[model samples]
Target: MNYSKIMFMIMIMLTTLMTISSTNWIGMWIGMEMNLMSFIPFINKNKNLKSSRAMMMYFLAQSIGSIIFLFAILMNSFIMTPIMMNEFIKTAMVIGMAIKLGMAPFHSWMPEMMSNINWNEMMVLMTWQKVAPLYTLSNLMNNWSMYILIILSTIVGAIGGLNQTSMRKIMAYSSINHMGWITAMMITQTKWFMYLLIYSITVAMLCYMMNMHNTYFINQVSTMNESMTEKLTYSILMLSIGGMPPFLGFLPKWMAIQSMINTEMMILMTIMIMMSLLTLFYYMRMISSLMLMYSSMNKWMKYKSPNTMMVSLMLTINMSMPIYSIMSFF
Candidate 1:
C-alpha cells in the first residue's frame, strides 16, 4: 500500500494495544473511541458521499452510546461504590455497551453503515476491535443484565440478518450474530475466550477473502455471470457462514452451545439454533446465485485465480479449525 495506508494500519495497531492495556472501563472506552476515530478516515477512502454519510451516522451513534457509558461510569462512581452497582445503572451501562457494539434494538445503523464501508475497514471493524469492548465488559461485571442483553443480541443478530442482500450487510449481520454467541458464552469468561479466539480467526479470514474478491457489492455477484470456480468459491464461503460442520464458523457456535446445554439452557439453545435458520437461508441465497454456471455473457467469464498465499492459508484455517476443536474437545 501507500504511506497513507501504512499510517492507517499503524493507527489501528496502536489502538488495539491501547484497548488491551487499559485497566479501567473509562480508559478502555477512550481507547475504543480512539480506535473508532482513527479508523473513520479509512471507511470512505473513495470519498464517496454515501460512505461519508454512513461514516457520520456510525460515528454519531457510537459517540452517543459512549456518552451514556461515560455517564454511567460517573453515576456508578457517585453511588459510593466502585464498579458494583444496583440494577438500574448496571442495565443502562450494559445497554450502552450493546448499543456501541451494534447489538439489536440498537442495531439500525449497522447494516446501513456496512452497505457503504469497504471490507478492509470492515475487517478491523469485525475482529480485533470487537473483542476489545466485549472482553472489557466481561471483565468489568458479571451480572444478570449482561446475560439478558447478550441473549437479546444473539436473537436480534441472527434474525435481523435474514433479509440482507448486500455482502457487507450480510457480514454485518454475521458480526452481530457472533456478538450474540460470544455474549451468551461470556457468562463463563474463560471458556468463552476460546470460542472468541476461534471466532475471530474464522471471521477475519472469511471477511478478508470476501474483500480480496471485491465481493463488496452483493448485486455485482448475484446479477453478474459467475464462473465455475467463482461459484464454487462462493458456495464454500456461504456454507461456512451457515456454520456447516467442515467450516470454521461451526466450531465456536457448536462449542458454546454445548457448554450452554451442559448448564441446562435448553430453551435458550433452542432459540439460538432456531434463529440460525434465518441466517442459513440467506447464506444459501448467495450460494444459489453463484451456483449458476458462467454463460458467454457472464461477468465472471474471465475469472482468474484470486488465490494468493493468503487465500490458501485462510482456506486452511477455515477447514482446520473445526476438526482441531472437535479432536481437542472429544
Candidate 2:
C-alpha cells in the first residue's frame, strides 16, 4: 500500500509485459532481470529473519536461472553450426526457464520461500512472478524433456503437500501442480492463458481471505470462531480451487481435457487427472477439518461475515458452470 511498493509493483508488471512482448531473447532476459529486481523489495518488506532468508534464496535461484538463460542465448546467437549443439542450447534454455518458474526438480526453493513470506507476497509470487518465465517456457516446450517435467511437476506437487501444516506451503505445492497443467496446455497450444487467468483469480481470492484472517496453518482454520456460513464459504472456495465441477476453476481444466482428448494424449491426460484427484483429496481433508471439526469456542467471540465484494465474487465463480452451459446452448 505504500508508494514505494506500489512503484515497484508497477515496475514488475511493466517488465513482465516487456518480457512477454519482446521479439528476441536478450530483451526478454533484461525484462526478467528488471522484474526480479522489482520483486526483491517485497520479499524482504517485513525485515524479519525469515523474510531475509527467503529473499536470499529467491535471489540466488533467479540469478542462476538468468545467467544460464543469458549464456544459452549467447551461444545460440554465436554458435549455430551443429544441430546437436543447437538442441543442447534449447534444452539449456528450457532448464533456465524451469528453474525460474519453479518447475519440478528445480522446485524445492518455492515452498520454503513461500512458507517464509506473508500471504500477500505469496500471492504475487504464486501468480504474477510466474508470467514471464511461463511465457518463455511455452516457447521452448517442443521437446520430450518438457513432457517429463510436466509429469514430475504434477506428481511432486500433488504428493508434496500431503504432510504440510503451513497453509502457504500447501498453496505453493498447489501452484506447482497447476503449473504442470499449464505447461501441458502449451503442448496443445490451446487455452493456457484462460487457465492462468482463472488460476490467478482463484489464488488471489484465497490469499486475500487468508491474509485477512491472518491464518497460516491448517490447524488455525478449525479453531477459528467462524459461523457455519463463513466456514461453508471457505469450503466452497477450497473446492473451487481444487477444480471441482461447476466452479470457475474447473472451466480451464475442462478445456484442457477436451484439447488433450482431441490430440490423443490419453496417457498423459489420465495421469494428470489422477494426480489432480490427489490434490482434491488434500483440499477435502482441509475442508473437513474446517467444517466438521470444531474446537471449544468462547461465547463472547464474534463471527465475521465475508465482505459484500467477496461474496459477490464467490457467487460469480460458482455460477460459472451454468453460465457456460447456457452460452454453449446458443
Best model number under lDDT: 2
Q: Report the number of the highest-TM-score candidate.
A: 2
- Estimate, for each residue in 212-251, the C-alpha lDDT of model 1 and write its tens digit: 5677665667654445444555566677767777787787
- TM-score per model over all chains: 0.86, 0.93
Instruction: Provide the global lDDT of candidate 2 against the true structure.
Output: 0.85
What is the TM-score of candidate 1? Answer: 0.86
| True-structure RMSD, every candidate | 3.4, 3.1
**Model 1 pairs whose backbones collide:** none
Candidate 1 least-lDDT 10 residues: 293-302
For candidate 2, which ten residues in a row score worst on lDDT? 297-306
lDDT of 2 at 19: 97
Misplaced by over 4 Å in model 2 are 79-85, 294-306
lDDT of each: 0.72, 0.85
